[model samples]
Target chain A: MMTYAVECKNISKHFGKTTALSHINLNMEKDKIYGLLGRNGAGKSTLLNIVTAQTFPDDGEVKIFGESPYENGRALRNICIVKENGMFLKDVSVTGALDIASSFYNNWDKKLAERLLIEFQLDKRKTYRNLSLGMKSQLGIIVGLASRAPITIFDEPYIGLDAAGRQLFYDVLIEDYMENPRTIILSTHLIDEVSNLLEDVIILNKGEVMLEGNSEDIKNKAFYIRGTKDRVEKHISGKKVLSKEEFGNTMAVAIFDSISDNEIRAMELDDLAISSIPLQQLFIFLTGGKMIKRGDINE
Target chain B: MNRIKSHLKMHYLNSKKSFVIFWSIMFAISALGILISIYFKSRGYESVIITNSIVAVVIFGAVSGMVCYNETLPYMLNMGITRKDFIFGFAIYNILLSLIMSVIYTLLSIWEWLMYKLLGFNYEHFGQFFSGVKGIFEMTWICFLVTLCATVLFTLIASIYYKKGMMFLFGIGALIMLLMFIPGVTQAVFGFLESLVLSCAGGKGYIMMTLYSLAFFLLCYLIIYPLARTSQIKR
Candidate 1:
């Protein structure tokens, strides 16, 4: 069994009367890139904050390396969070900010920082407040990757980056992860962009773990079967129906779990199509997108 | 040591521009004081000169609060350092900066006093400007302590509250204090503090007060450690 880097047990948090997170339990293994996927208000950020000791849970506890991370300096230095905004002193130049980061993170790799600075095309003399949103995100990516913490979490790492910058960030992240693999939790709404990179995917909905498994296993467990409305409905009658759509005489039913020979043969009817369900569609189904706006209900 | 040096270098470099404006204004004030003393000494005059600790307190408090608010507190959550490390690092940096500012101001005052005597004015007639060495040191130390405590208190408040929450907490705190209209509460609290201060150094009230002042500085930091560790970062 892989050693779990972060273990959370029934974690719940509240800000006054507003519940930010509720009954969240998670076990994250080391050396794997896990995607923390959720819609807006899914409590992904709150979970990350609690595990990183930035926020305290009202009930339940979190452990990093089998120890409570609260006020634990030894544990904290091994965790790095690259938030969306990439906070830094407004007056401090890029070089100055990097210098501060280096001093603070004992694991900081100067060479990696230098290379990333050049790759990201961020000016060393530009003050942090003056940098464009894309550049700010890039700076955070550099710090997160270069910190080389045992547990590295990035919350929406590519929010403002253009296509090229996003590509650069993803490419660099993959290359670095391969060279020095660590426990990486990437929280993002851009699921498709990072689909191929994730070894495991955890979908959070309403502050609860809606679905989690190996990426391939998760894909194999659900499939899209399309045919005549009656035929598709008969085929998905017993299996768990994740989602369904109908147009004219044709229908598509997303069935969870393995489809049997009879179900597969049901698609042999004329004008029928059977294909693998895309992860995004599964995410949408699991997150309750049909009934309400996904990521809207704050769990 | 290296980390401390790097932070200092960064702080100095980032603050150099503001320091230039501040020192210029300070120089002008020193020059004006010297000229005033010289003109007065021409006739018979004697009066005590006092440094405005309030101005120094505000400057130091604002600078400390702003710097920590911008850089230190926000990053502490993501960094590997614990709250102890963060508070200690901030305390060291604050103390170093306060020492530099106080020393510079003291030197300027001394320079003004010397200039007054050198401009053909009688030293005794110029008034007792120095207030002796111990007095100057005590005043500087007191100013540093006040600024340090006030800044830490501000940071603690900021750390625990932000935007809407900040206003709410402040409003609530003020409301509670206002509602506590009972007589002698203020006196009781002050008396308790005064007794604690006296006990720290065997009833040498002045010395104990100095030590308690230092303790208050540390106490503010201790109070904020848990706050920084558990506080959430607002978007």
Candidate 2:
């Protein structure tokens, strides 16, 4: 039996009639990076919270390394979730927070934390409340990287980080992950930026799993076909069309299907354009297109 | 056990700065009181500086307990600490803090007594209010119990507030206000509280107070444990 680092089974959460998550099931394997992609209020944070036992699921269960994480220190010690806000107390200094984390995380890498502190240029003496938004994000990043927990999660860890800072984080993350492989889950809106870093992708759409598969496989299966309206419609007649957009005499339809090379060549010969959908575009087409007001847009 | 100890260490280190500030302000107050007493003595007037230092510690305990949930719970939960360990570690920290504060209060009381002897000024600590409690052990015991009870009670209140938010406090205030307007209810409530205090402080002396405070602490814990265990971490 293949062991999973984190298994969420039929998890559902409701907050005052708003369904945060609905019967969501996910299995994240060990030693792989996963991109938990979703639009706002798509329940990514809620799912992560339930997985980490920060909040209980209304139904179903979450298991970390085959053990229930809720109130189980043995199971919980193997996990670390760095949230976007309010992870550290306002009065706690950067060093104080790191010290607390080091004490709890048995495999904590102090030297890496110190090095990251310098790399991020965060003052050890600065209190959490006094840190800028970007600095606070850097602190969260340092903790997440240095904890070395078997299952490390970052929920919007680049909230206020600049482009250079985010690039640095990606570099450090990739370098460290290569040396010390663990299950890392990155939940963020910057899907394109982290798409390359993700081996597996889980896209949540309005409290449900819209898509889940290997990044390469998903991209390979999803395609955008652009041609005359009748031709595009005919091609996508029996396919799983995720989204459709009309531009005057042309129609573009995004579909998730496997096509043979001969079929693609035939479509290309007929003056039809076929292009592989980027992860971010695929994600938008899967989650964003449905919620948007199509009538408001000009063809 | 190691997790619990780690949580305890986190709580202690987080509160260390506050502890230092508290003691610094306390010593400053004591010094100012001594100066005023000496100046009064030199003018041939008898001025007594009655410092009920235990009150400050009790208040500190209450505030600390009330804020601990908000200040530390999210941070601990984010660090992947089990709720059980957090609560257990917090309970142990509370007990240890009460004991340490009691010891410090006892020492301060003795020091105040010596100052009184040297300066020929009357000094009365909070312990003198309880009749028949004469030794340092009794004083420390009472201090510990009172501080522990205050801490536990406030902790329960804070937990309730955390789970239910400001609405619970409003509901409580509204209930009290409604009860106060009812005929004979206010008197009945005050009468019960008065008797409860008197029975604890009356003929049985320190022993009764200790038992009463212990019972209160246990009751508070019984409520706090369930509330905290199931409590969700709020951002």
Candidate 3:
């Protein structure tokens, strides 16, 4: 039996007639990094909330380490979710917040937390309300990293972080993850930045799973074929077309399907330019967004 | 069990500074009252100094209980603390705080009595609502019960508001208003409340008041436990 770190079965949630999630099922393996990619209102946060047992799903169940997480301390202790905001009280000092977190998370890494505090240049004496948005995000990052839980999740953890800060986070995340392998879920809009770190990618669109598979496989399979209209259409005829854009007589089609080397060569010979779509562009296409063409904009 | 202890420790650490400030302000007020009494005494006039410190303690309990739900619940839930542990740990924290406040009030009452004897100043305490030395025990019991009940009741209200939002509160308000329009309903409600207060005020009714307060606390806990267990941590 394959043991999953986190599993959701037919999970559905609704808020006042708004379907936040609809029968979403996911199984995250242990010791692998996952990218939970989604647009706004795509139910990424709602799904994360349900997985951590912070909120109840209207239908279906969530299991952490093969046990229900709701009110189960044993099951819950293994998971730590750091949201973009409200992780600590306004009055709580940074040090106080860390101390509380250290107590709750059984596998807390105090040394790492202390080092991160100094590295991030966060003032221990400053209360949460006084910290700038970037510093607050840094505090959350520190907690998420130092928690060392079996299942750690970061939901848009880089909200106010600069490029350098985000890079530093990526470095530390990779280094620590290599040393202490655990299930990590990074839910963010910065798909391009974290795409390299993700082993498995799950894209949600409008309360449903639009795509889920190995990152390398998904990226390799997603390709943009651009050429004359007839050549592009004929080349991608049997493929799963994600989106299409036409500029004058030229047509660009994004398709998600395996391409053999011979077929790629044949498409090139037929005057069809084949290029692998970047994860971010592929995400946009998969989530019902059309690529903007220069001709269309000019017209 | 360890989780509960850690939670209690977190509560203590979180509230330690606020508690110090609260006591400092309380003692400052007490000192000012004493100074006024001494001034009146020096002018050959009698002034009675009444210390309603128990009221301050009760208010503290209520406010802290409500704030606990707002501040700690999300933080704990984010940290992966189970709702069961949060509620259990919170209940323990409430009981312990109530006991400590009750003891502190009892000692303050004794100290006030000593001041009355030594300085020839007329000092009355909330504890005096009950009789002499027996009043000490009754006062402690009543104070503990009141503080605990207030804490639990306020926590229940806050939890409901956190879970159900303003609509639930408005519904409750509307229900009360509708009941008030019915004949004898308002009178009956006020009459019941008056009797409940009178029961606590009269020394002989201490046992009854204690029972009523315990029942209230239990009811609040029963409602709050399930509400909290199922409550979502709002982002």
Candidate 4:
């Protein structure tokens, strides 16, 4: 039997009458990166909070290394979640915060902390309140990477990082993750930028798990086909059509369903174009399908 | 217990600077007051250094406890400190802080009393509530209990606010007014609670007061743990 780094069963949460998550079951393996993609109010942060034991779910259990984290200090030592908002002591300096984190987490890496300190150009005495938003994000990224916990989570960790700084974060994350394999979950709105880094994907839509599987498999589950209206309609028959558009007699339709290569060949879109969708596009379609076509993106 | 100690260490390290700053200011004022007292005595005038440093210490201790619970809670929980550990650790520090400060004030008061003997300068202390060397232990225990009570009360209030925000106080206020109205109308329970408070305040009820304060302290912890257990960190 394989022990998961993080696992949840029948996880559900509610805020007043608003259901934040419902009957969501997920298992994240060790030494892999997962992209939790969702639109605004899609419950990504709520789910992450539950997994880290920062927030309790209304109905379910979350286990880190096969142990419930609630009041389980030994078990929780394996998890570190850096939120988008502040997590550091507001009055504590950069070094002070690191000292606090190092004391709490058993697997803290001083060398990694020092390297990130230099990488981010962080002054030792600059308190959390003194740092700009980008600096705060950098500090959080540094903590998430340096703690070297078995399960590390970053919820929209790039709140104010510049494009370059964000790239640096991605580089540091991948480099450190490669050196020391651990489960890492990055919940963010930057779908395109993190799509490549994700080994598996869990897409949430309105407090529900809409899609979750291997990243490549999720991307392969959807394909775009273009042809005249009659041909497009016939090809999409008895298939789950994700989105469609018609211009004059020509029509382009995106289908989101399991279709093997042989099955695609059977459809035989003669005098038509067929292509697989990018992960970001597929995510957009899966989440809302509001931006189904390239022309629809601008709106 | 080890976890609680580790959490206590974290809380201390995180707030050491603030602690130092607060105590430094308190002592600076106390020293300045002592200097002026010395000056008066040098001029052959009477000088009495009335040091209520116990009150200052208690206030600071309570406020620090409140700030620690309110501000560092999310970070502490995220850092893996349990609610029970946080309460226990914070309570330990508050009690220790109160005792230490109380002892320091007693010693200073003793010094001031010596000044009265040698230089005709006097000092008044809360220690006067008791007599002889026993006053030191008595006042120390009193200060410890008082500060511990205040600390736990503040923590309880912070946890309530954490659970229900400022609106919770309104409900409490409403209940207070309604209970007060019972004297005009009729409510046996309200009268019982009123008598409980009055009995604790009477001069001859030291044991009862200690018991009452301890009960309140335990009640505070009881209310705080559940509130904290369900508290959500608003990110």
Largest DockQ belongs to which candidate? 2
Locate the minimum summed-lDDT window of 10 residues in model 3 chain B: B126-135
Task: In angstroms, give how far residue B199 of model 3 lies from its true place.
Answer: 5.3
lDDT of each: 0.73, 0.85, 0.85, 0.79
What is the C-alpha lDDT profile of model 4 across B77-134, one tens digit per residue? 8777776676677667766666666676666556655654565556566434333324
- lDDT tens per residue, model 3, B7-112: 8878887787778788778767766766777787889987676775677898898999998887888878887888888888888988998888888777766766
Each model's DockQ? 0.47, 0.75, 0.73, 0.57
TM-score of 4: 0.85
Against the true structure, what is each candidate's TM-score?
A: 0.81, 0.92, 0.91, 0.85
CAPRI grade of model 4: medium
Candidate 4 DockQ, CA atoms = 0.57
- Superposed model 2: Cα runs more than 4 Å off: A227-237, A243-251, A291-299, B126-132, B176-204
- 2 or 4, greater by lDDT: 2
**Which digits, one per residue and each the tens of the lDDT, describe model 2 over residues A124-221?**
99988899999999999999999999999999998899999999999999999999999999999998899999999988878988778899988888
Candidate 1 residue-wise lDDT, A1-299, digit = tens: 44479999999987677777878778988888999999898889989988988777899999888889888877776788888867666777888878877876777889999999998889999988899999999888998998888899999987789999888888988999999999999999888888889999988877777777799878877788887898777666767777778899888888767766675665565446778878887788777665332233211
Query: Model 3: residues >4 Å from true position, as ranges?
Result: A228-230, A246-251, A270-272, A288-299, B107-118, B126-137, B184-205
Q: What are the clashing pairs of model 3?
A: none
Q: For candidate 2, give the docking quality class from DockQ.
A: medium
- Evaluated on chain A only, model 3 obtains a TM-score of 0.94
Q: Put down candidate 1 lDDT per residue, B83-188, tens digits, no spaces.
A: 5555666667667766667667667656665775566544431222223324667646645555565666666565556323657877879876975567887778
- Categorize the docking of model 3: medium
On residues A1-299, what C-alpha lDDT tens digit does candidate 3 reach at each position? 88799999999999998999988888999999999999998899999999999999999999998999998888999998989884787877999889888887888999999988888889999988899999999999999999999999999998889998899899999999999999999999999999999999988888887778799998989898999998888888877788889999999998888889998998989989888899999888766565433222112
- DockQ ranking, best first: 2, 3, 4, 1
Compared with the true structure, model 3 gives a TM-score of 0.91
Error of model 1, residue A42, in angstroms:
0.5
**Per-residue CA lDDT of candidate 4, range A1-299, in tens?**
88888888999999899999988888999999999998999899999988878888999999888899888877887888888985888788888888878877778899999998898888888989999999999999888999899889999998989998999999989999999999999998998899889999988878877777888876777789888898778767877777889999999988877776676785674666788888888777767745333222211
